[model samples]
Target: MTGTQPFVLAEQALLGALLLEPSRIDSVRPHLRPHHMYRPAHAALYRALLDRPPDPGLTMADRTMALVRDAGAHAAGITPVYAHTLMAACPRPRHALVYARMIVEAADHRLVREHAVRLGQVAAADHARDGLADTLTHHRHLHRVLDDLHRRRPDHDTATSTPAVPTPELNPEPPLPGNLDDEQALIGALILDPAPMSALSRWLTPADFADTAHATLYRCVHALVLRGEPVDSLTLAWEAQHQGAFAAGDGGLTPELVAHIATSGMPADVDYRARRVLRAYVLRTAASAAAAVGTHAGDPTLSTSRLVTAARTALTPLDDALARRHNAITATKAPFTHTPPTTTATPWCTGVATWPTTGPDPTNPTAAHGPRSGRRP
Candidate 1:
């Protein structure tokens, strides 16, 4: 016996009930479809049952034999021996609806799991291509399937205590081999020219970096740019030191390495390189979300509603990244720079020019101009 044997028995019982009382097929038909059968042979038998209804003139034994013979035309391996086994398994044919409901619940669980597996496959493919559009399309399809399952679920569906979902047998396949290299390149490009940080910052975050050290350095660069401070190797190294990026235990980033990273990439490609890093983050997050959905779907103990809810929760991170990407793409321009409150002169300003509190007013030409000289506005 295997983990699936219980469902197999349930399938057998449902079939047995319908076999004993062919009239009950009408009652079960609304709730149980042929595809709901876990075994292909059983599904073939179901279709046979529907197609070769007992001739009113035939004896029950004759009808059973005829249906069993007919099912062989649709699927291989159907035999009279199994037909006898199914008939003997029926406890009471009158309760056929109950058995049908049982079969439907188990079948729905299997369907949900199969759908999750497909979604995971799509996400894995997207990861291979370093893209998210196809993954998002499949993600949406999975949700639609889940929603339809929720509506189809019998009202009596009771919540079972969710059994623990087994973790992936192996750690998620290590991230794409090129992810760290892309992170390094994006960081290097941004350090070489901070101008693109204005747009990149709107959608990209330090946490998106796949490498811990790269993330730290990106954060340093992001901060310097946000403050309107000049971003150079020296300024970044100083910020990194204060952030403890070069602590003894941390070996990935050193002062000399920071200088190298600052000059390692072409500044002109900063925006394009930054998008690559962001794409990697999205792909990784989508793959993780797909895995979580699969895990939840596999837990037979979870009700359809619970499974759907769990899947949505697992997908939240990917959804967030998608939303950010949409915002970045749709915005006409980056929002105005927001400098933190400081009593001292603005770090990037030459003298006592105070940063403006609001964005430029299109109607006021002067609103776009800062203090003209070394005087406060």
Candidate 2:
């Protein structure tokens, strides 16, 4: 069959199964498990649909696949395979196998062909599973023993083109001068943009990210924060509105260590937007945890889901308010304080960026809400 054909067929097959009983997902689970003859992208799309606002006419299976496509998921068959592989890496690979099988069987040869490329691309030494022969298999296991390995590998720094090291006394290049709100508006974009779209997109949105400066700042902070480095103390030779704590020498955590802790199972691309969103989420999550700690003495509140819920509840109102204000200013091209600077000495330092800070922000109208959160702001 053709490429789209298998998607339709697989979608229909799952829909039929779902019609009998939404809870009967496992009944068809056998067809999707790992090592199955024909592996489809673990009908991950279908399973992902279970967690959304109700949509009529379509069964959970159809909606799940639809969501996948909307997010630019390609190679209907490969989708299942990737899902399976991901699950294999999960603490429990069983569910990944089931979902993968369903999508595979539903797909046709065309999907299989295209998807083969991706499977090969990611199936490198690092992603492959390892264990039996060598106690530490797979890159993940190797990572568990990274410090030991680094100690053994010959030190051959490629001094010709090496990235600069961040230090404690560093003062990052100053960002373009701008008013607090506009700079923050830029920060708001950075803090909210999701680096990768997945099932989790339905849960929350970051509240504060604004622009590229925020994005850079966020990446620097996240890279440092994940390493357990102090955000409030570090100093770096970088400058961006989100760079406050990061430049301070407290990149919160180191990059390698941070990657290990952010188990969201997706990468936070070091892009201006993605990093910004990550920074906001990480910071706010930390803030919430801190707040929870403080309030624990007063009342027992701010459970993970509740705090996340509160953020979700406030997202719409906050976004709408920001949009109206931004549009009104732009409609007249009003002389605003947040406008970017016209000249720059270097792309990284002066090209209309914001220098991050931890001080009081008057424009932080919805500081109460974070996109990934579920509590009330």
Candidate 3:
């Protein structure tokens, strides 16, 4: 099947830009993978761009010829002149990164569309067999596949040069819906009264907040609480600025936002709001764990024991969090009491010794000594 035409154009433009200016390859290479290009020739050319060594002496034409020869474009009936054709077609060489992202997005869309068609066929077959449960499972699997494809991005470092492609057995985690309202309310409550920060810190983390701005604000407040500093609007704005949290643009935290949250009608019951946030987080975590277990359940390579262990590992954090909450409630209800010392003192040191009130005699050190000190012992 033919790939999307716009993506093909984008792929050509990116490759063309790289060929025209190899110096910009390092910046664009991290975001673009060979598989991101839909056409085989384009993918091969991108691979060659990544694989080629830095050679300042080589002219652009020589480099283009080398890339074409090394990529085996001759087999695809491509030539060195095609590189110049692409360069001439490209509108702006400086927008290579933008074109690279467009390619990735287009590739993702195509993958999702293809998978959806396949999933529809499977669902139809399963429905004919009267396997409703199996059909639902396949639907969930398809959703996870699409979700992984959308969320996965290249890492900053080249620990793994290749991006992980989603498969039936080794699918990435499904995206869960976070309660943004609860997250914002909890953060606002904290800004209103920093006292709840101590309790919230035990059960919540910045990761629990769905909004990036809220997470940044929570992190700042948590740090201030740890350092015994005030967590008012001004301090939070300062901390956010210092941490570069507000530089993200658009939805980033701002001083006015901080002040508004602080002055808003925050929940009088801060603990209740905190628990709501924690509940949302726990539910989201449980759903993710269940999805992960379901995805790996059918893998033949994973032993039954390994699958069980994986499920346990995924669910253990939620279990531990609930256990801690229960323990905290139990402790709060119990009375406080001072316990006596458990250890006994030695008999030889039970009695106290008297000391002389006078200062030590410098003229005779022995004169200041006690009766048992100077003569015999």
lDDT of 3 at 212: 71
- In order, the Cα lDDT scores of the candidates are 0.70, 0.32, 0.59
TM-score of 3: 0.41
Q: How well does each candidate superpose onto the true structure, as a TM-score? A: 0.78, 0.16, 0.41
After superposition, the stretches of candidate 1 with alpha carbons farther than 4 Å from their true spots are 1-4, 52-56, 129-133, 154-173, 248-251, 331-377
Of candidates 2 and 1, the better by TM-score: 1
lDDT of 1 by residue, 254-329 (tens): 9998888877865556656666777777777777777777777777766666666677777777788878767766
Model 1 residue pairs with clashes: none
Model 2: residues >4 Å from true position, as ranges?
1-4, 29-45, 49-102, 105-377
Clashes of 1: 0
Candidate that would win on lDDT: 1
